[model samples]
Target: MFKPFINTLALSTIAIATPLIIPIIAPAHALTEAQVLERLNGIPVFTITDDKGAPLLGSAPQKGSEKPPQVLLFFLNPDDAQATLTQIQKTNPAVGSKARIVIRSMNDAYEVIKKNQDKKDIAFQIVPAKASIESARTILTSQGKPADKLPNVPVFFAIGGKDKEQGLLTLEQNGKQLVPFFFDQKDLQSLIDRAKQQQPDVANATKIQVTSLFQVLDSMVATKDNKPNPDTERFTFVPSRNAFEYVVKNQPATTPAPATKK
Candidate 1:
């Protein structure tokens, strides 16, 4: 029983806001372990660790279970991890001061989880950025759909096609057409705006679609062998630029060598 923890408030919000079309987004299909891990590669996730570089674990009570399960928190945004660290520092300075943020690809985390899948003591939980969640909710509401159907971090993509049928919009890069899914809504919107200016005809038909990171990963696994077009295999995930910048800025400063005595 590997349970991914979602806080009570967020869980309640998801319950009320999830649209009826969730099943369509995340179809109930069995995916092999290799498929799952292959899809997770290159996606970055953040975590907090002690000075010794071990992930900090937290326990949350599980319904119908006597003992609360231990959870390792994975953050979509470095800022969120920093916020958690700040709070820990306020309450427990000694422990917090020694804690640091670590960046790892989602595949790296999944590999570890897969190795310990049989163990019942711990589970991995994803902590989405509040801003991203709010953006997703707003988009869903505007479309007259459920506000928060995504289970994990929301991914935004643009779609446009002829008639009733629609498909992901592709952008040309280095002579290649690539479909981009963004972790940040604002980034996706920016691309949408540029596309609109460049192709007015296509812009009028463009629509923004929202899905969860987990759903996207699962979809890759499900569709791996049956891609409708070559471009479908070129799907690219665009991480939050701000989060990347934060990681670079906070990287441990390199130690300088002592100068020889004059």
Candidate 2:
């Protein structure tokens, strides 16, 4: 009887080992893109907190209340965060009443927000970064990016509600339609580096012509199929082209024009 029991135990061990010997297939996620989109569309809220840990948007929209278009700016580096905030202020007249500007900031963003909170030009809010990262990751994942690939620093997005008609959905500059693009500090730095190499005069100039700089980058991308490839949320967007244009037109000669690329 002991011999029989030992044999049965051995057989059971082998059965478990056999499966392990083969490659294990990872299970697919249950939610499809359509399902995810449906759920997201229905829940158009990004739950985040203020520097004080209070809800950002009053917990939730009043039942059946209409949602506005939201322009979100995420920064990796604190230094760059201020630039985004300044740009929004410069562009408020053009972006007027279209949508509210929301900047994602770490707990550290509190002081920065306090400094500029009195500014009346921009309709803006500073949201806690920790509370917003997961939502950003969810969006990134939906765009086909792995969670680990998410940026540690700063990025920006202009999110629209399911109903597109009521928000800052599209931009028109000299008749060309513009879209929002997501990019990191590295991408911006690369553009600046290349500009320095190819056009040192412009790079070294006291005041950079943002329109000309943007034109150069646009030409480079136009030749190639350079498009923002986000993995999670389908943005149908581009970087802050309008904001740059606004800054160039509104700011004084000393203000550095924003340099960004696709």
Candidate 3:
């Protein structure tokens, strides 16, 4: 079925092995790039480029724009959508990030990510990226991809309206284990404030090895070597404004709540 199996849209995805087995594998690809992009939620900014690559509509924020959308990107390794949610809350705290955040990892899970959405409060809106390398490169550059800095799985990006990577945040934990670390609100706050700092130009984004969230993002994407997992995560639904009341009640004013969550 590999050849002449389906349409010309080449579909490739990364998957995690679960304990359970499926009696029958589904037809078509498990993670379709188009389907993933449809599930995202937020202010919903996009670029409608012409055939020659000119913007028709739906552009991102440009420099010197005060109201530009704040965007954060999480590149997850093990690529579990459920685990993806916890990491976002811990690092970015969905409730107060004034910026829009998107988590991209290995594709191949719809129900898995969706189930988590029903139960927990995913602080920010989620959106999948273009599954393939070429398409993804286009979206990332709709702003600009720091091919020099970010590299591989678990890369985080803090982007402006024009889609430039202002602050890139990366994480090391494999999907869900992020719970214990982020549980402490005070500690988490410190990291959030730290994300605001500007990163220096990566000497060689492609050659860089990832140890921290920021370094990985700055290195990996800059190289443009690794292709993002096809099943990029996107927000299907978002929480209401009432969501942040809990944070306000518990955290001190020093809390770096850049924006409100759900």
Candidate 2 lDDT by residue in tens digits, 113-231: 33444443222332223423454466567666676654332234232222322222223344433222323222233334454554454333311111111222222221223342222
Worst 10 residues of 3 by lDDT: 1-10
lDDT of 3 by residue, 183-260 (tens): 112222334444334322321121111122222212222123444432122112211112222222332333121211
TM-score per candidate: 0.75, 0.21, 0.17
Model 3 spans with C-alpha error above 4 angstroms: 1-167, 172-190, 194-262
The TM-score that candidate 3 achieves is 0.17
Model 1, 155-194: lDDT tens digits are 8887775655556666655564556677788877776667
Top candidate by lDDT: 1
Write the candidate numbers in order of decreasing TM-score.
1, 2, 3
Q: In angstroms, how far off is 58's CA in candidate 1?
A: 1.0
Query: How far off is residue 234 in model 1, in Å?
Result: 1.9
